[model samples]
Target: MAKIAVVAANGKAAKKIITEAVNRGFEVTAFGRRAENDTDAKNYIQKDIFDLTREDLKGYDAVVDAFGAWTAETLPLHSKTTQHLADILSGTDVRLLVVGGAGSLYVNPEHTIQVADGENFPEAFKPLAQAMAAALSELRKRKDVKWTYISPAADFQAEGERSGKYILAGEEFTLNPAGESVISYADYAIAMVDEIESGKHIQERISVVGA
Candidate 1:
């Protein structure tokens, strides 16, 4: 079984990922500032993201970075934490899977502009989105680290049923038949663990949309 460590495990997305991974029989360790009130994983570690050392992450097969920040002031933590992980996992076999935002996804075929740069993008969420974009950029430059950044659909729903169905795409934004860019957190978690097991999109940015 793959030994997986999920950072920021208390978050909604992380919780779903943890549940899905546990259900799939993967050995999971939950890492966060506090223990999850309800978690299936038997192992739990409470520590600040930056405080995690290479030794602390040594044996994990893969690390799922589910860390997120909502405010502009704390947005820089996204890139900072990503860089720290990259540095620590540089020569190790441990793969890093980042739960990214949709902001960096391309808005057009040319891929000249990102969804975060589009006019309709919400202003309030721009800082957080930009932070995730920066994290992706940082990951892309880490040649020594195995990393995969998975961006969710444009409309990422926090509450929805897990359909066990989704469409995986490259850097460009993906839309469903009805022209909607959306995916529930539950399904997104399923997609994430699937990618972790497959290792199909390593060292790249991929997106998940509703099927």
Candidate 2:
């Protein structure tokens, strides 16, 4: 069985991922700030994310980073927490799978512009977007760590339906057949668990949209 660790396991996305991985029979350990009474995973690690060390994560095949920060002060924690995990997992065999932001995905084929740079992007979300973008940027520089950044579509919905269907794409942003860029937290979880089992996009960033 694949031994997996999910950070910030109480979050909507992480909870869905935990449920999916557990239902698939993967040995999943959930890491969160507090113990979850209703967590799907049997194993749990209740501790501050930054306080976690490599020894705490030893023997896992992959670690899913579902950490999130939306405020001006907390937004920087996105990159900080990613760097912390990268440092701890450096030179290890464990794969670092990050729950990335779509804002950083390229808007054009030339890769010169990102979704966050677009005028249509919301001003309120730019700080969080830039922080996540920075995290992906710094993560790419670490050749020693095995990392895969997965960006969800522009209209990521927590309450959206889980058709268990999605289109996985490369760096450039993409839309589905209906001309929509959207995905549910449940569907995105399917992609994350699939990646964990397949390991097809190591050291690369991939995006997912509803199919």
Candidate 3:
């Protein structure tokens, strides 16, 4: 079984990933600022993400950076936290799988426009989106660490249905058969765990949407 560590494990999306991972029999350890006794992961580590060292994550097969910050003042933490993790895992074998934002995914085949650049993109979310895009941009510049950024659908629903099906795509944004870019937290968790076990997209950014 894969020994996985999920940062920001107490969050809505991360919690669903933890549940799916645990159900799949992975040895999952939840890492966060606050320890939740009710968390579904097999183990828990209470610590600030910035304070985590290489030693703290030495044996894990993969580290999922499910860290998120939505407020205007805290948005920059996206890039900072990602850089911190990359710095600590520079020369190691552990995979850094980031739960990224869809805004960074290109909306055109020419690689010119991103979802964040679309006219319909929400104004309130631009800061958060830009911050995540920065994190991904920075991650792309690193060659020492093995990384994969998984961006959820443009419409990432916290309480949406889990149909046990999804469509995974590359850096360009894609819509499902229904012509909608959406995915539920539960189904997205399935894709995350599948990627962890398969290691299919190292050093790449992939997107997932409902089938």
Candidate 4:
């Protein structure tokens, strides 16, 4: 069984992931600040990721972070929590899959969609956005530990179905099969879990979208 740990597993999509993972017969562990609703599996655990020590990561084959800067207001906590996760993971042989912001994904050789010069990207949100970018930057240089930073389309929100199909790529690449870009949170999770199981992508940043 694939032993996986999902940090901040109380989020909407995360609940689906845990459900699907358990149904698919994988050993799933979810750690978060608050208790999740319920699960058939006894893998749910309550703990602040920031409180996790290096030993905390010993058992999982992969760590999926659905945790994002909640409100633009929580970037400080976001940065701190994220950095702590990255730091702890960096010390181990485990894989890291933290979601990045679309703002940093490049639209052209000279510019990125997240922040354009003189353009506003959520100011309060930028800190964690920046944190994701910085984290990906550091992860890119590591030869050990598989890394995959994912971003949703511009239309990403709490909607869609678990169709189990989407796109994947690294920096400077965009996966938009519809001519325009968009993906359901469900489809994104399907792709997310698929990657966790397949181990096809290692040390890359990709965006998820539908056709």
Candidate 5:
């Protein structure tokens, strides 16, 4: 079975990914700063994201980076952490999958207007959004590392039913039949794990939306 390690494993999205991976019969290890003992995984580790070494990460088929920071002061950690993972996993078979933000998604077909620059984007979240965008930029520069960034829809929700249905798009924001950009975290997790298993979008930034 494929072994997967989920960083920031206790976060809502990470938890759902862990559950979904385990349900699909993959071996999962939950890595978090707090290291909860109650997760339904094969293993759990409490460690800082930067402290993870190539040796420590060996044997896992893939690693999902579910880390997030809200404040402007802590937002830079996003790029820093991405660099660390890229440095450590460079030339290795382990793939890095980032849980990215929608701010980087292009608002138009010409690739002109990111969601972060859109008028409706909340000011309070712009820092975090910009930080995630920076992380994706950094990842793009690492050609030796195998990585995929999955950006959720602009209306990504924490509480919604897992219909087990979603549409995946490349870089651009995906909209459902209602012309709304939205996706539930549960379904996002499903798409994420599906990519890990399929390796369909390696070295690409993909977006997910409700079907």
Candidate 6:
């Protein structure tokens, strides 16, 4: 059985992914910040992903990095943790597959479709978005750990039904009209687990959207 570790498995998406992966016979260790809300996974390890050591990160075939938040202040959480994980998992064969923000996805004319409306979207949101972009900049500098950064749908969130259908693209990516790339937390989990099993798209960024 493949051993998998889901860092920051606290969200609906992470919970659903761990659940589905466990049902598929994968030995999953769902790690989260708090132990109180850990009934989501079959077996949960309560720990902060940022402080995870090599010993803690070892023995896992791959890591699904669902450790990020969408806010005006804690925008750099994902990338900072990514830096930490990169250090821990470096010089080893452990792979890091992360759930990234869609702000970095390509828009027309090579611009990213950031959450920028000047006023409606808080100034706070831009920094975190830019921080994630900076985090990706750092990720590209590494040649050690096999990294695959996956972006969420434009409408990827707590809402929406589990259609189990979405589109996957590499590098430059985006959504269509009426949020064509929307995928529920369940389907996003499914896609992440699927990617982990296949071990494809190493050291690259991919985006997903619903049909």
For candidate 1, lDDT tens digit of each residue in 1-211? 8999998888999999999999999999998897444566789988888999999899999999999888767889999998998898999999999999999999889988999998888899888888898888878888899999999999999998899999999999889888899999999999999999999987999999999
Q: Give lDDT tens digits, candidate 4, residues 1-211.
A: 8888888888776766677677778898888787654544467778988788778888788888777665656655555665677778785768888766665677667545443222655565556567666666666676655678777765666767656667765555365755656677777777777878887777777777765
- The models' CA-based lDDT, in order, is 0.91, 0.94, 0.93, 0.70, 0.90, 0.77
RMSD of each: 1.1, 0.8, 0.9, 3.0, 1.1, 2.7
CA error at residue 145 for candidate 6, angstroms: 0.8
What local lDDT does model 4 show for residue 172? 50
Report the Cα lDDT for residue 192, model 2. 96
Candidate order by decreasing lDDT: 2, 3, 1, 5, 6, 4
Query: How close is every model to the real structure, measured as TM-score?
Result: 0.97, 0.98, 0.98, 0.82, 0.97, 0.86
Looking at model 3, the pairs that clash are none
lDDT of 5 by residue, 1-211 (tens): 8899998888888988898999999999998899464567879998999999999889899999999888767889999988898899999999999999999999799987898998888998888888999999989988999999999988889998899999988988778998988899999999999999999888999999989
TM-score of 3: 0.98
Give candidate 1's error at residue 173 in angstroms: 0.7
lDDT of 6 by residue, 1-211 (tens): 7789888888777787788788789998888888565644567878987678899988989988777677756776767889899889897888898877766766555544544423455565677667777787788888988888887775676766778777776655556556565777777877887888888888888877776
Worst 10 residues of 5 by lDDT: 33-42
Residue 117 displacement in candidate 6 (angstroms): 9.0
Q: What is the Å distance of residue 176 in model 2 from its true position?
A: 0.2
Model 6 stretches with alpha carbons more than 4 Å out: 70-73, 109-124, 176-179
Total colliding residue pairs, candidate 4: 1
Model 5's TM-score against the true structure: 0.97
Minimal lDDT window, size 10, model 4: 111-120
Off by over 4 Å in 4: 36-41, 110-128, 141-145, 173-175
For residues 1-211, could you state the per-residue lDDT of candidate 3 as single tens digits? 9999999888999999999999989999999998564579868889999999999989999999999998888999999999999999999999999999999999778998999998999999998889999999999999999999999999999999889999989999999998999999999999999999999898999999999
Whose lDDT is greatest here?
2
Clashes in predicted model 3: 0
Candidate 1, superposed: residue stretches over 4 Å from native: 35-37
